[model samples]
Target: MHDLEGVDRGVNPQKTSVSALALQLEELLVSSDRRGMAQVRQLWTPGYLHTAAELFVRHCQRVVIVSGFPVGETYETDGPAGAIALLQGVKDCGGQARLVGFTPYIDRLRNCVAGLPQLNQRDLLALDRSGDVCEQLQGYMAGFAPTLLIFVAVPGQAADGCYYNPRFEDISDRTLPWEKLLELADCYSIAIADSGNHLGMGRVADPLARLSIVPAVSWTDGLVIADIANWGACGLLALASAFVRKNLLRNLHLTPLLEVLSRSGIVDSVTGMATASEDGLPAFSGEAVVTTLRNAAQTLQSGF
Candidate 1:
């Protein structure tokens, strides 16, 4: 309600402090200057995160969260934890939310759910990791009737029509065709990614070529890029909770859920070993990011 619209990167910071905080939040989330990701900075709309929260809170009633990127026998540790937080945020907004992924992610979500029952194991949906899932996906769409689709660290096919990990290794045989699934729903889509390897980077693929990885062929209605996928998801949660007047971060069990994820045979994208770290950053790193986001959200909501 701070009249954030039409404000040019917080032109009137004195009165539009909420917009200022939200704009600052946006800048913080996409500050990863490494890997030449800054090339797409031009495409990212100013105050778009707050705008997205408004759209989601006002329009979305049913949602499906797509995540999980497996490496070898290990799943990517980034997606599950963030997916859980997003699921909670969605439910807080009075939307029915479900998280869909491969067996590894579903397993971790289930394990984490034993301690965090708020996630509800029944909301976890699994798709075959290396098989054709067209029928399965269609059944899920028909059953859930989600109004929005969210991709968290899920990889997208490259221009060569193959899916690759950050290492540029083809993981097509191990990953799901997630882009096709979101297209099938024909609903609102948001992508949270760190690099061009993830789904929906196609929105800024050309500019991302400087990052080295071939940009994804899939595009989404909205995209949020953090140096790490989990951090971006937390940033999104902060904006959403502020708009809805709910403290969605209070119940965020990021640490415990991440502990469960570490034990779930998922390797870090950087270390290539199973640990609580994400891409080699320590586990507590996510905690710091989440805390920062929570504080920002409080500042905006308190109108300080």
Candidate 2:
């Protein structure tokens, strides 16, 4: 097990070639820096660095929660809120979880759940309309040293009936693409988990592409993905599930998932010990969903 005690704060320059990337991102945060913007254009994709910085700062000290649309639904649900729910679940199990919301959606979620307890709103760096998700993720991982990250995809309508936007193709063209998101998992030593597949949005190419990037041991069928039909939603769940499976529950370097679960009151069901598989993967019908979720949540809490 890797000892997380006394882990250094800030990015390890040797671990990632991100110093140059950081300068470009810093310029974007500074408004009215026309020269900086020009310089950014020559060295990297415009707005890409900014988006990555936003994601990094937002996820700095916490686990990531992502939600989104699936294949069948018209307007599946709010991705940010679903992410929040997962975070809350972690907190409920005595875990420390941070909720990272993508700009406009974050604001909308705040308005939607005005009086909810354990839901404090914080600003994640913006990636709005920049048209580059990969750059955003790269900048985020460079800036924030989060051990776990969850990504959710919301479902919405496209010109051809209902479909998820921001597919892998939409984000992969940039310099640091979806492949980098997975790389961060390996680099930072974070676990990546996802929920089950759904019809609404989980079928998108980006989520699948992300799944392909990570070690298969780190991936899993996430919650919303299993319930919904949209590929976008499924992709988000996959990201979250992967984080939980890899970083939280299964990593021997960190606290054991069983210890967290026992503390969270999820280890023993009415029948007996909760006979769950690693990372909550299938093959064990004896485990209860509530217990499994609680166990996952407890693991997040222990990460902090």
Candidate 3:
């Protein structure tokens, strides 16, 4: 395995050639950069998409994915899309995958995942905030024995052991102890985040903090940063689809998922409304992103 311990500090650019799928996803992320700012180049290390996807495919057979960011009164739109995409991508590879999130978002998650043939009620686990979370997760890990723990747009502990939302002002007692459990469990972990406050940003906290970006307090074996957390998740699908030479992402299904999420009261993080958009971009942006992902898979299909 690659030495990922130094990833939190920042990785020096290597001479490695990145895959076409990763490059395309990176381009997509860069395109979404705020006001032409080079946050992606500045905050994210090179070759992350390829490395993370490879690590997931190589190690995570029974994957446990966690998401759901409380951006407003309810769960935001960022986490579910990535969680579902990664779940589907993992399942498409014939691997078992499950979704985990806070208890408050259980109904939303159920509604979000409803009618999805790849997922079932058994695949969803809620982090009961009122109970002993670590103990509950420990029991869960004992039974599921996940090979890898992935955090998609999920908030992480701050240096003070508290969880903060995107505003970095709202504090909450609702925290998951996945990072603490990862230390004892025999598994690898990856964090997918757009904002630095989410899990996995701890891997790149140094560079990000040098620029005054408040990064997540918890760390992981790998970190994937993007313009939006869902994009990072879709980037993984693109990578997995390319690696396995299969179009795991379908455009027809992508639109309906967002529509369902909107109808279920999942608001866009950017617009803060229950709309068919993610992080403020319209629904067509979602279609365009998935189309690019399919194109990347097609490139691999032709042996490129």
Candidate 4:
């Protein structure tokens, strides 16, 4: 969902007609330049929401979703929200979703799942460094035969062959090289992220590097960029709900999700502190995003 300013300039009208709910959801999720770092980049395209939604419905069945970015010394408050939301979205669409994360953060991931049973996602995975992580994932894929592989807020490898956090600092040892799993031919890949450091941002590495937000290149078949990674996933759910007209995301409650995660040691990625927030947004910001997303779904459901 690269937010390109002029993607609709000469494209097919039907393919480029982004719905109002999708547009409003995009606006609410774009980074507000909070750090004054001016690093919040909008790498989206017209009809991204529709395109991703169509992909979700037409081709995805058993899906593998990966998240869990360690901000400083622990898992942060960004990835899980998006991952959980997407898991619920997938299940609501008659698909099965399996959650994967580093072993260090598996407990936190479990906490998120246990606290939100309404999402009905129970398949959680732990990527231990004891063996080849990619091989294990390939084995899992062989068994599950997923149709889509989605990475949300997962770090991407840089030119230095190491994973870097948002500050351009190295974090390779703590992250799994899960991007390598994309080599599997059985499924298409979609990445949801807010910055260039994410696994999917490799598709636009040059633009991100020019802005100095990304230092290395990585790629994914489909990319969804947003202000907060979770918000992008929520937008996808909204689009899916509209497409199926079944409220696929009705059970997603962002505030309670954040609070559960906060108590479970999920810190704010931006502040690097344990707070019930995403990136560095306050509680109300999370509330506003969830409200806007629900409103968008309501609008679409009402056939407006």
Candidate 5:
């Protein structure tokens, strides 16, 4: 019998909901800017990242960065690079940050299990084996004691032949379930920042069940899902900056940041902009992308 009574009480065995509350508190403390607003609508919809980031930054002192399913071979070329980039951006702006690679053993185990029948016990076992990465990651965190942890899911090419594999989905979400990480980190008082996969990850089957799990995971910081349709890198940077700015201002008033961004018409530019493609995706020019990144960097520095 699944113990859902715990959920009604606003807590999970992993304490996911309580952690989400912490995230909510943080957002309430910060002032919202235009970019922040756009990010809020795009990423969180009814729920918001600014609120979460505010609480996480206010409470945590160290951050651990994790990337999901990086395309291509190991370290130098995978999804982790994006996670590394964000950490570097934070470090460059004078924030404490560290990079942790998910264990390689998990990948090897995956290859060995790929020959099994679809959704067989062997397949499930193989996916379960990937949880070892989480265990190793937890051990590393215990020693480092970071205040915050950021997980980025790297985007891969749509043309890549590796599509429609349910096993990959199971490996990504279940083996290293975010809720489990939140439970482990909560013990250390570390906050979580997650940029879930670019495309909606397994939402159609049970949307509420998926979303419900999110609240159980402690996300005191930002939750960014890159807008794949339009803007791409530009959208991601803009969202990240907005999240950081809102968090930094939790202790202070938000009016000044709002005034500057508003007066400069950055908000209008972002909102009035048309989708870059017929699919309603955003397209950004090279210079525009650079400017957005720079703006995000500045936001991190200014504590907007």
Candidate 6:
């Protein structure tokens, strides 16, 4: 999947090519220049979406997707749908997938994706961020021995050892430090997020440092940034589906999914309200992304 050489099989001669489709995905997802991340976005240039998707399918076996960014009493809506989508996507690619996050949030995320079929409850793990681990999490994950670790919008530790919200407040207590797990990374792992504040986004910390957003101390082998974390997840799946010639997100009902999450009290990361908006954008924005992605990926009609 990394090579993109074989992805262009069909010839519409008019529709956007897979490479151009990747650029389109990037334009929508990583379009933010407000944080001075324009330079940061260029780090994985040319084909960040395609590169991340290719990296995912290549190392998707035994994948553990870590997500859930904590808000006041609940979690943000940006992460859940994306994380679940990634988990489902990984499984669709014939990989054994699992998801882990802090308690309460994990429970809520599990509830949101409950209607999705073939997902086992055991695959959803809740780590206690209260005290130190009640059990040996590292050892437990060692048992799983994930081939790829995909973190979608999980908060990252700053240089001061605290996780900060966009307002520059300390939220470290609510986060689970995944450093121990990230230590297992090789050349094959993927992280989907918007800003440098997310886990595994340290790769672009240098470019984003001038901005007010605190950069993460952790980095990943592959980073996929988006306008919002959910869009990042969608683009990742869309690109992967394009490459593999199978619609991984075709079953994902975006509207109902957000409605379910919103009803369950998952708030927007920016507004901190249990509304349909994701990171302050209208509900339809996500729908538009998925719709465009569906049309974009449809042209590449050959299997991996």
lDDT of 2 by residue, 1-304 (tens): 1111211212122333333323322232222221122232334333333233233333435555443332121112323333444455355334455554344434444543334444565533334446667667666756665555555433222223323233312221111122234455432212111221211222233433333221112221221222111111222221233234322222111122233322322222112333222222221211222223333324333332
TM-score of each: 0.88, 0.36, 0.87, 0.86, 0.42, 0.87
**lDDT for residue 192 in candidate 3, whole number 0-100:** 86
Model 4 over residues 263-301: C-alpha lDDT tens digits?
888898778777888877776676666655665565555
Candidate 1 per-residue lDDT, tens place, 1-304, comes to 1122322233322355565666766666655444444456655557666665666666569989988887777687887778888888888788899999877567766766666666777889988845558878988899888898889999899888999987788888777888877757968888888788899888876678667786787888888777678877888887776677766677775676767677766668777787887767777766766767776665555544
Task: Decide which is better by TM-score, 3 or 5.
Answer: 3
Off by over 4 Å in 6: 1-17, 32-39, 42-44, 118-120, 130-135, 185-187, 301-304
Candidate 4 lowest-lDDT run of ten:
7-16
Which candidate, 4 or 5, would have the higher lDDT against the true structure? 4
lDDT tens digits by residue: candidate 3, 60-95: 589999888876667777778778888888887888
Task: Estimate candidate 1's alpha-carbon lDDT, on a 0 to 1 scale.
Answer: 0.74
Task: Give one clash count per candidate, in the order shown.
Answer: 0, 76, 1, 9, 13, 1
Q: Cα lDDT of model 5 overall?
A: 0.33
| Model 1 residue pairs with clashes | none
| Candidate 2 vs candidate 4, TM-score winner | 4
**Model 5 segments more than 4 A misplaced:** 1-47, 70-81, 104-135, 154-179, 187-222, 228-287, 296-304
The candidate, 1 or 5, that scores higher on lDDT is 1
Candidate 6 per-residue lDDT, tens place, 200-260, comes to 8787766676667878878777888876788789888878886667788777767677777
Ten contiguous residues minimizing lDDT sum, candidate 5: 117-126
Q: What range of 10 consecutive residues in model 2 has the weakest lDDT sum? A: 1-10
Model 2 TM-score relative to the real fold: 0.36
Position 275, candidate 1: lDDT = 82
Clashing pairs in 4: 1-223, 1-224, 2-43, 2-44, 2-45, 3-43, 3-44, 4-44, 202-218
RMSD of each: 5.1, 17.6, 6.7, 5.1, 16.5, 5.2
TM-score of 6: 0.87
